[model samples]
Target: MDIVEAVKTRRSIRRYEPRDVPKEIIVEILQLALNAPSAGNRQPWRIHVVRDYRLKELLTDAAGGQMFIMEAPWVICVVAVPEESASRYGERGRSLYCIQDTAALITHILLLARNYGLDTCWVGAFDEKKVAEVLNLPVGHRCVAIIPIGYAGEPRKDRPRKSLSEIAVFHE
Candidate 1:
């Protein structure tokens, strides 16, 4: 699907079919995510693709018992290493710039999943410390989000959204 269609149709898939998501597809999706712009090309994000059932359970527990994580065939943990970013903007680059860059990568992954006939849920409700421990993330890396990817088990309806006129303000 095209970008516009994908953006309109993509939804947080909570239920998934009992199927496997191949490593190659996951890698390609991650590669697309890496294509996102970063401050000074630091590329401070690290993606950990988890397919193990036990680790998935741990992630579900880390996410306050969100069972959909365990049900999905794959869970991608997006991590940000602030210290790895360029210090041109000083502390702001470490905190703000790196975080924004990582979030952009996550957005890319989500959209590309839809284009590839797959679905994912943006999970930011998890306990970061627990997630880091579960994934054994390297030092100075923080778990920004946990995305569960798979084929949808059921249909999803579009959620309510504010109109552009209501959200956007024009100064000129």
Candidate 2:
């Protein structure tokens, strides 16, 4: 699908079917995710693909019983490696663009997945410590987002969004 079409149609999907996503498709999504731009070309992100049902259940608990985390066929944990930036840009880096870059990439991945006929919900509220433990995240890495992906269970209706004039400014 065209990028514009995908962006307009993509919505936060909360319900999913009980089918499994193909391995190749998952790989494709990850590939697109890594293509996201970063500061000074230093990509500092690691993704954890959680497919185990037991682990998914644990994630739901960590997310305060969002429940949909367990229903989706796949959950991905996006982790940011801040050290990658600190080593290159020094003290200025940690206070800089690493988090924003990682976030942009995740957003790109979600849009790409939506275009591929998959659905996702970006989960930002969760127990970081539990997520780190469950995903076995390495030291110095922070969990940035938890995304649930699968076939969307319900047809989407557009959510309320601000008008263009309200959010955008014209520069002369």
Candidate 3:
């Protein structure tokens, strides 16, 4: 699907069918994700693909009992490496830039998933400490999003959107 169409149709899919996603498709998504834009091209993001049943359950528990997360056939943990950018941008890079980069990567994942006929939900509501423990993340890297990807079980309507003037500002 074209990028515009994908952006128009992409939805935060909560329900999924009982089917496993092909590894090739996941790889494609990862490729697209890695190509996402980052400040200074730092690309300080590491993604962990979680398919193990036990681990998914642990993740759901860690995420304040969000049951829908476990329903997807696959989960991608988007991790941010603040230290990767800290050398050049200092505290701001570590605290903010890395997060922005990771979010960009997640945006790519969301769009690419739709392009590949898959669905996903951007999961940010989770316990960061528990996530780090569950995934055994490195010291400087932190979990930013835990997205569940799969085929949509049912159609979902767009949530809603604000007016352009309310969201955008004129600079010139």
State which candidate has the highest lDDT: 3
The local distance difference test score of each candidate is: 0.90, 0.88, 0.93
- By lDDT: ranked, best first: 3, 1, 2
Tens-place lDDT per residue, model 1, 61-98, is 99999998988999999899888784566788887888
- The local distance difference test score of model 2 is 0.88
State the lDDT of candidate 3 residue by residue for 106-133, as single tens digits: 9999999999999999999999999999
Q: Could you tell me the lDDT of residue 121 within candidate 3?
A: 95
List runs of model 1 lying over 4 Å from the truth: none
lDDT of 2 by residue, 1-172 (tens): 9999889989998899888889789899898778899999988788889899999998898899998889888898888888888889886666566788789888988998888899999999999999888888888788889999999988877999999999999999
Query: What lDDT, from 0 to 1, does candidate 3 have?
Result: 0.93
In candidate 3, which residue pairs clash?
none
- Taking all chains together, each candidate's TM-score versus the true structure is 0.96, 0.95, 0.96
